[model samples]
Target: MYLRLMYLSSLINIILSFNITDYLYRYEYFDQSETTTTKLESALIKFQEFYNLQVDGTLNNDTIELMSRPRCGVSENPSEFYTYGNKWTKNQLFWYFAMADATMLKIANRVFDIWQNYTNLNFIYSIKNPDIIISFSDNIFVHKNNPRCMKGECLFPFDGKSGVLAHAFAPRQNKCIEIHLDKGEDWYIGFNKTPLAQTSLFKVLLHEVGHTLGIKHSSDPTSIMYAFYSENTDHLSKDDIEAIQYLYGKRKESSTTNTSTTTPASTTPATNTTNETNKTKEIKLDLCDIWTNKF
Candidate 1:
């Protein structure tokens, strides 16, 4: 009877802890009843899912071990990774623009899901506004007379066809990113045949967005940010979240000191009210599309 009661109590605690790591900061006072074998298994799964750890239900030494540890795995890598050419292939050229197909939507959702699990940061996506945009010029190698690609501030890291695929601006810009659109179609993956595992342009673009958002490559092998992207690659690692959040700052109470942008909020005091009201209507483009389009 005592064992059954204990089991019952643990079951209640387990159900209540559908989201274990969400309360990571409050684990100090978490009810002990919630730490039973079954309950622990459930919580551990949450932990595993969040970190992409082994998902075995059994709370073996590996699982039991990380639970007691503070999460410092977020900030391991900081370098960028890219394709060898830094230029797009034939496949991308045939398509002109990388359309938002099922694969793109799937990748976007996967990005959201991973971020939701790892961080508390806000990702404001727009319905009418594509998450990214691309810019292509006719000239190659020189920005001097190349299409819009040469215009000062056209987009960083892309000098027309200068071997730089595309450059995603820092997220703080809150605007569209640039990609060289006219690349070969051969660079793209199957015509929507398989899942997101393969090393397609869609996959590369997805990974690059992580870089633009401040996620550095990970030492962990399973990560999308790993040095060499592959077909079977999974989502971001806990390290990826750590790196990204570090760049954008973490979940903290709102403060005025850090709230303001470089241009003071009072710059256009007379027109400020009008601009603020109009801000809602402005649609921002996505970084992935812009950068990948160039490449």
Candidate 2:
């Protein structure tokens, strides 16, 4: 009787701990119809691989911790991995801030400039007939109350302070691209402060701008487009530059304008003046002490 009771207790514990299936389903890792054990394991493995976690196909402590960390509301499934359906056809894209503080707007502009430095795209700030619109919601209920969120325009409703930071829609012809941030999060501008509970507006906006450009979440954790939010990263990684450039060719260089340099399509000696200036810019941006454990 004692042995039977112990076995039953262990089984109960295992069943209770297997709570990640719902998360898997929500993130497009699992289909409702294919919830068999083999399928579940497959989904777990896929998720682990994307996040560079151990591929044991089990809901380990590290996996649970990662899930608990705040991330973008965008789905990390393979179906929409690198680039979403179509890239924007035009080179010049206009953006408008439907809702944002002056600080947020400034940081957003910087983020847009960073992206344009590496891609053949120009982002113009305008309120009239904007291609992309950005806004913030106080909470999930703001969607039901706001008219702009109606007619399939709303993103997955944000989950309070720290679960989901923000989300953005990919480019669609004639449809305004939307990027919604969670106002509940404590947003900050600079990277000088360490161990801050605040989310970096620059990082989040940079990631969402990638989405608006029709680039999807990157599996590389070092990339700004990584689904999960981390303060450790400030600039774009090689994967991020490659993914964006793949969609919109490299920015055309002008003799008078200094622009950020990206990874070349082929290996070349870094002896050019342009490359030296870009290297200097990157070094300046890395002056902050990155608090990796905060996330």
Candidate 3:
């Protein structure tokens, strides 16, 4: 009996080690080539340091819990230095929805407004030749002709429901800026009424939009740019504000007047075009029913 219990304990440790290693590799803590024991510990330590967790180089309960939480698909920076040296040269940027409904459009407008409130940048809704394009999909196939999937045939395909809620591309010269949300997620619009299992479209959009503007993930958990999603956080933290301002100087005093309005842009209905049309309809029926009833 004693030997059996010891064997079970060893099995559990092995499983936990595998999970931690996969998590580190997935989030860019380290590369697959450097999969030695020391490298794994170092990567774990780096991840802990980023989240302000105790750096004991061990997979404690806290680390495992944090790892399981929903987070942006974008990988966290491996270094202390923030900002990827990528920023839009133009102040006026046009964005369009390749796949979204009226409700989603409204939420996006509010998100863009939040960013505009801080920087000199301006976001406009355009139907054609938009600088940023947003979409919802369960699986993103790589198109060799497409710059967005430059790395390979499949760039971080969505794994359904929880793990990665969304991901976006930073500004790049001659490359398209894109944001893709997992259609499988139970996405709610507002802060007050979000169900425990549902993700706030507002918060996710707020974070992805930051990425569209070339803002990288922040180590500060309070910041919207933080890799992991937090239900309690509704607005940008100081780190978020500073990061945006650093890329594009603060909003001018005269421009303090709120020019952008939360007007829903005419966008392609998600149910009308994508392969996930049926799924999108089901999501709207379930979530929007509650949304309409509340307001």
Candidate 4:
């Protein structure tokens, strides 16, 4: 009897958790039951289904373990993975745009600064064919059935009314990244308290930039990369930082390299061949269809 009571309490805690409870509500689990075995089982089943886990409706070890894993807003399409491998090859990447208002541009620069502070990669402001472009628009879809952007294209569109707050494309060679902000949505400049309906510009841009840097969403609720946006005070969680590091690697110490005064030796043919091979190994990604596969 004591063991059973303890189990019920544990179940209650899990059900009440923000992430789990939010998901349950989405599936129409309105009943607020603390100890009801049936309700708990049903909720667990729905949770498992959403995650593509084994739907036994029981809180098995696998379910619990999966709950702890990081998930991305982007779907794990196998073919897409093959095409847009991951990570940027160069350290200095440029972000170009004048589409947003002055206020938004200021905030965006701050976001860029934060990302650069944490990683070796940099987001330089440029006008001449930037690697990423920041733009704003509304009514992205012409018809409900057809989306303006296709698969593997780096153009991201945001219709404010659409459930999607914002979306971004992973890195691609041929196409430059285009991050779109929904013009209809109310965007807050700073951390001032705002209603649930209004979205924070800084937070959204930070997450989108993560996508551009080849980061998937994290399952950890505290992570900025999580599918849902929250009003958390922290800009980047440990998981979020780790995810970027996995792609670009940890920020290295800056030191100037001394140029060799003696450049008399010519490069061997074998050395040149190896250098060419390394450059050719660059991975290409098709971000055209990425917005359609959002989680």
Q: Which candidate has the top score in TM-score?
A: 3
Identify the superior model by lDDT, candidate 1 or candidate 3. 3
lDDT of 1: 0.38
> For all candidates, what are the clash counts?
26, 0, 0, 15
List the lowest-lDDT window of 10 residues for candidate 2: 267-276
- TM-scores, all candidates, are 0.36, 0.75, 0.79, 0.56
Q: What are the lDDT figures for the candidates, one per model?
A: 0.38, 0.69, 0.73, 0.54
Q: Write the per-residue lDDT of candidate 1 for residues 120-168, one digit (tens) a residue.
A: 4443333223333422333242232223222453422222211223334
lDDT of 4 by residue, 1-295 (tens): 8746644554555456536544454334434455366777877775666546788987676676544332223442221221236677887777754333334555566677677777777666654456776555455522111122233323334433323466667887644666655655666655456444456777778877878878765546677766556667348888778777677778776712211111111112110010111111222224442233221
Residue pairs that clash (backbone atoms under 3 angstroms), model 2:
none
The number of residue pairs in model 3 that clash at the backbone is: 0
Off by over 4 Å in 1: 1-99, 127-167, 172-175, 179-182, 185-198, 218-221, 248-295
In terms of lDDT, model 4 sits at: 0.54
Residue-level lDDT tens digits of model 3 in 1-295? 8746644554555455546777788888999687999999889899999898888888876676677677899988568456778899988887766546656666777788899999998888754446777777667644223333234434778877777889988897655567888877877754355765578888899999999898888888888998988877779999888899999999988777654444442334443211112112212233332221121
Q: Which rank order by lDDT, best down to worst?
A: 3, 2, 4, 1
